[model samples]
Target: MKRMRGLLVLTILCFLISSVTSLQAWEILQQSGFSQALGDIFFIDEQKGWATGYQGVIIHTQDGGKTWSQQKVELPCDSELYNIYFADDKHGWVTGSYVMGDGFILNTSNGGETWKIFKTKDMEMPYSISFIDNKKGWVCGFGNGTILHTEDGGKTWDVLYKPEKNYLWRQIFFENAQKGWVIGCESPQKGKFFDTIMATKDGGKTWQVKYYKPVADEDWWYPWSSIWFVNEQEGWATICKKEATLLYTKDGGETWTKHQFNLGSWLYSVKFINQKEGFISGNLADSGKGALFHTKDGGISWELTAEFSKSLRKIHFLNSQEGWVTRSNGYFYHTINGGKDWECQLEPKTHLHDICFVDRNNGWAFGKYERGGGLILHSEDGGRNWDKQRLELPSGDWQMGIHFMDSQHGWTGVSILGPNSTGAFLQTKDGSKNWSITEIEYLPQDIHFSDAQNGLMIAEIEGGPLVMSFVQTNDGGESWQVRNKVARDKELGGRRIPSRIQCLNAQQWWVMSSWCLSYTSNNGKNWTQKKVPDTSGFYFLDDQIGWFGSNRLYHTKNGCQDYKEQELPMPIEWISDIYFKDSQEGWCLGNRYYVGDSLERCIIFHTTNGGETWEVDLKSPQHLHRFGYASGRLWAVGDNSVVYGIATQAVSALGKQYITLGKVKTVLFQNYPNPFNPETWIPYQIAQDSDVTITIHNIKGETIRTLQPGRQRAGAYILKKQAVYWDGKDDKGEEVASGVYFYTLRTSDFSTSRKMVIFK
Candidate 1:
């Protein structure tokens, strides 16, 4: 009976262990500090509120803006949840527009515990969504002046209105069921840009233009940003042309008041708890002062509340007294007694612009010129945690590219725009502990270093006619010279502007501008152009093999000498980037539409035997833009500053094989002839190319010799095909006095050591 009880307990423990281990863990989603540029915030009774922004990030705080928790939102790449509205804790609706295509609407029934995704027809980018109840709602944005209306709890939507040709609108608000208002810009040719607002009083039957500013607003660079309404008659709109203006209306848009202030900034959002109390927040257009403002007696009088260094993106108030705000620098601020006193809420951030990893343990990321945005971060523990490293460049400059060849050497290009727009190139010698700048004229469009010395940089020629100057730095960015100039030929563009570049080593590089694909081999000294129409992205595995990712997939095994276009099972819009470990393992990141789905999705395609056969690796709800591979780990980064990754051990080639793989996995076998006389064969197989190291250690944990080091691309895994022979030798090729020995196989995502007897 005692033995049976023990066995039953042991069986239960094993079951629990197996159940926990059986789940397929895809990847971890990390919300970096850059995600806090909250686009919109909604509060359900001061306690529960949801905020969404910067890549479809929707976070909920049950503690009155004191703490926020990130929800498990399965969004596609570049999915930005720009606006949110909640009727109550249990029912709510959210809206967002993706950069690639269409917008998204998400509904929750159990207070955001779970979300049911609803798709709208065609490619509609809904920026603002409003609801009178859970059943009746309206959405409006720039889908050729797009507007969607739903009455059945958003299960279905009808296109109620679409503006004529060049007109665009956003920021829709509905007070009760019959009255709704929207504010945006629309004007005729040779006519001044109008600050306009339209109203619908009888549901969706008719519309009226109620308010208009004949001249453009303060900032002429872009259209006005945001609008809000406490009720049908009382509303506020923030506009910027060259300066800033706050417009308020009282008599149902019939009469309005304008307040011009020297906040030296462009206001973005407005919120009012009642007709008598309100607040506004935004960023300074230039470097000035005064960001947040408060008014107790309506818009009659306003007072400066608080100021942030960067710009504010959103503002929300739970009651007349408690409020919350989010800024572009990934900061969250909350106020208890109105704006008299405020507190900062902290959240971890992972959003960076350019990221690079040198080994399994060393990595770095750079963003804009703010915290978690433009500063440099170094990780010694394989990106689990990061510490800020000072990068010396001109103040207010932003890093465009951060590339590293190894642990100790790297280069960064930074640019500051305006009248005094200057570009600086920075290089670090001792890893990323510090950075020093190099004089780079114009702007650095692309930066690459093939090795510790041979590197290439492409910068715009100073005071030239949109020309790209090829430059080289021989002594690691110590000095640079112009090799040649590639002028921005007008005939090459006037199609789709190519705003991206990729560099492979220093000798080979690829750049796409519009329909023109340019390649350079002699460090950009000369260029070869290929007019490939409808080109989106391209990846080259070697000088002779490459693949182009457009609406369809194209391959060129013999460099660009020959191209073959292949059609996919489903329609794909565009592919951003691609990576391949070898001819047998590859990945493609792009936007795709699957049959039976209402809207398109951001997807990842995996190929086993190069680009011969492909399958979906990940079909995400949020959009993923770029992917980085280092050591044996693949990391994906996108809109909301979120990071997703998979390590070597987690790499499962269930779809493709590497050279008629036996198990399609990473395998390390025990050395042959355990009690042999003088020599043995050490055999191992990895599914993909990884940094592999094999070391022998004695019983007291002392290193005996290193069998293999450096990068080993995916190779023949079967024994007798290719094997590493160990002649029972040490580093000096001497037979070691051995009793017990341990051999270890370590890579980025995988590591295992086996013990063996070394009898002599």
Candidate 2:
């Protein structure tokens, strides 16, 4: 009888695992949204252009920058694409680097419908690409001032020059097949560096230094950023120094003159439509505001034609009347009338830090601009369209905490600059259309309001020992009173500042930090400290039911009298936020840090058994900060303007299948020992007898193998012995290359897919 009970328990555990892996994946509601910082842009004409930037993103436009579409590159999606060049309408090239210190070049011959990738092992980080024609081009970057030449349309490349160690080539331009120029900077010793412009006359067989800037103090050095030539004799270059400097050459490459602008700007790119009309793009040093300067008298006198919230990276012009400028914070502008008017091509000029939704159709996102100011964005139709809210704020002010009781009652904490920069709270009673500022003596880190007349704030008081105080307001934030203060533990020798706060009502409050957890039941008249396990996040459904998350999850049901530890399937480094709709359903955002790699990939974990077990619902490259639930959907917002939403009903439906409602249906589990070297196992389960098959495909969606496992009986095939196996080979018995691959399971009426990685 004991053995029979053991078998039943094992069967139930297998069913739980199977059902947990079958949950619906989260979908991105809004991303990119022109929020990727663009590095370079190129236009073959006024109608067709391409821009490359962060995250290996390549966007193309066919309607004169009015609309854009993403293009796939045959490399890691996280690689950094820097420079793009098109020799004509049909052929083009892009250069970028991976975070793991490897440079790559992408070429397209059919107008970017597809791309072919070539790895440059010798060039650690290629920054610039210049092609005089389709067949001959040169690339320069930071492999000890490396210059590479490609004579056969980038199929192969030959090293042309590697001047010295600690040299970084920034930009390259070629006027013809034999005459080319490379601008870069080099550090001869430890403390100082200088800039140089080198000219190659024999298609990169040899080079001569045409101009060299002497090394200045270690505190200051002018580095060349970009160079452009309208004709053989008229050319221009930009130097990114404390003050913007322009280098001009009228007599070919023999003689050059310098022009300086005392606007406290750092110029990046220079372009000239004719000898007399030119433009320079950069940003102000103090304010980080993107600025575009136009020169109408051959680089003699300049006027500020445009400015943006972020710095400008590159500027391109087909003519004086038609040009494009790319900002450093994922924005681009187009002008059709010689810089007199410009139209921005992207939306959301801020990096969202937190988001809240009172209902399914109404929400608000809080963030700060790249140039240092707070921003409030409101959406009326479930974040499909957002409009910026106008608020009169001090310069250099940013929001740190926000809470909204409903659509009409909201408050935000603003951190400003000046003497006594203690920050202030902006309270709104009529849906943020108007706000009243209430100055406070402490900086608010997090705030929660139970009603319009009662709220609690976790604030930081500046003085000594890093004090964190809980303040309360009973009259709608018109005034605040300190309730309790927690100071740093001098004996522990670690800063203990409150990171998150929750207010259940006027009498119940909870506050947590990395090293401590505390709660107050009667408006902070008394407090009790609960033992925590290096807490990273905390969530409470009520005073009795609460959870604390770190590498592991801890749950309490009796107001922290005792805690139960829940085992997660995989190891997590940290949990950023937690949200629970009820006692049985919850979600937590975590990050998994790999050994020897600096990148921390974010993951969303879902639980339906009241933290008894958890399953990964989503994986994202961007960091997610908070989670919200409204109208049967779960929402998350984080870095890079990412907003993701998933239907909670779908999750609940999947949860009910194996836990309560019925038997487990077809379910596909993620492969074990993911990022395998020689082999991996694919686990799955089936409810009834059916024909089962598994197909493997590469990242490009080309099928590599189709495994016919024949008919399988109803049961959980989740163990290693029962799972389907792949030997890391294609159907033709050839070992597959190391990269990302997808495996799909099809059984009768059900089909699903999951991703895996292979590293050799």
Candidate 3:
């Protein structure tokens, strides 16, 4: 009997594997319009090197910066990446900050094709990184000039030394495996803190202050930007002083001479291609254009090349003729004739966050629409004219959920849950042009379609006390019906209430909010809620393999029947969003999960095996708040109209395409007559939500009462969760503040923080 049972199980497993293999694969789609900014840069040999910055941004150059492709860094969905250093072509290090709170650090062994994020208890905002060899590296960030040293190729980190006080060490460089120096600032400064350089000789065991006093140009007030060392004795540093750019150096930190600026803009970057040739780029004093200067005799003299007048934040040179510079104007300039001339690269109307292309011809981009949504842009024409489009939405009438059956036929959900407004279930028979909208009642969150006709929609109910599931049909948009809840509802203590659904898909799906994941094969008809070890959103490339996104990552290859939790090295604790192109190509967003910090920096991570493991894609980093995959591109959207484009598999170009979501002038106010004797009404709009929170707070920002904080079926809400009549008391049944209290209503990711005066 035992043999028979084992044989049957094996047969079932094979059948399942075959079934999954037969399913059609999905591809990334188009994008909208937005802005793009850049950060840290590094070059291995002048021809092959990588740079990383905000939003896990990464970029690579193989043909010497003539063109670049976006690379991937191993950061989460919401980490505001900082710096990156490449030891050679294959080994590198990246650091950044978490959106929710804390810091991030990651390393790559495979030439940035993949990266592994390391963990350390003290891992915070590591703004800069430097790797001397394959196994020796250093990372610095936070308020302190804390230097973290790693010997085993980033397998581990040890605190070699912490500076006397907190200093923002922005950049670090190493000429050899043992000799290195760091450029930063001392804290508690009255105004502008000058560069305070530190050096270590014996593998970081002992350190000496290279320049204890500020550089002579301190009175000019330019923050130190970048540092480079041609050798232990011959090195240079760039500091943005007043209106002048200063390049100074020491015979190994013993004596320093500040170089004269060729232009008046703040020199953000300085690079030496050889001991003979170098370049500098930065903003052009009120010119509103970027300035680029080149030098053939090291830092001796400089010549102005092109002036875009915007902040040319970064510059990379392959040879003298072929180079590229990224500007703060949301554009990138490329030159094949060295820095003598330049031309601006244009992208679709979508604001790009980061960009990468495999070669001059083939590339990929990640960005978002300027209207506060995600987008993906592509270029088949050497970037002369780029095409733009939109990504799939989750649901609720906004086309939140989208899944491509092939390169053409795609299915996305049209959410229909707004304040007295409803949407449809849409299908693009011809690649997002003329569409169809099937009116539905439930507020959809995510949708997955296996083919053209069959699909599933994960939606929530009205009043949101619970979430509902449904198997949808596209047979002329005839009828849609509920299938089953992915799992039965259970409270924190088994008191059946309802589980708030965060994410859902077609094949191998899971629901969150109750810290439980349910698996279903028969289309949500029957679900087996698997008690997972992690407590956030669950993503599965298939029914068996999946990853948990939260404070840590819990992975299960055996379909949640069993799982293992892996603690991330990042100091933050929130994985905000995720995107997976295939089982192998995936991305994640993160926000800080601390108690009371509110800077939602963008963190992005990539994976190849679904979520079995993840690595930071440093090529395209930005502080993206949201992302989506559409057509053949990825879209990342965030604050300040910031976006990017990962041009191709091997190259990337930066640009901005602005778009407005159409003016929304109307404002929805909160409810009135709070703490009324009997009847009260709370008014709001249904923009987007799987959950909402309406709480009453006192003047001092204290939760005076919990009016309603849970799932609300999409639409305008004026309902009551607790008793409509209150005895004029707090939760403890004591008479609360009488005059002019406030009640605030918010949603899962949207908080109005609006106030309504409550009278006793």
Residue range 447-518, candidate 1, lDDT tens digits: 767777766766665566367666777877767778766556442212222234566756777765435566
lDDT for 327 (candidate 1): 73
Per-model TM-score on C-alpha atoms: 0.55, 0.74, 0.45
Q: Whole-model lDDT for model 1 versus the true structure? A: 0.65
Candidate whose lDDT is highest: 2
Provide the overall lDDT of each model, using Cα atoms, as 2-decimal numbers.
Answer: 0.65, 0.73, 0.54
TM-score-based ranking? 2, 1, 3
Model 1 scores worst on lDDT over the 10 consecutive residues at 8-17
Candidate 2: residue 87 Cα off by (Å): 2.3
The residue-by-residue lDDT of candidate 2 on 245-296, one tens digit each, is: 6788877666668876765477888888887899888876668788888988
Candidate 1 lDDT at 161 equals: 75
Winner on TM-score (1 vs 3): 1
Better of 1 and 2 by lDDT: 2
The TM-score of candidate 1 is 0.55
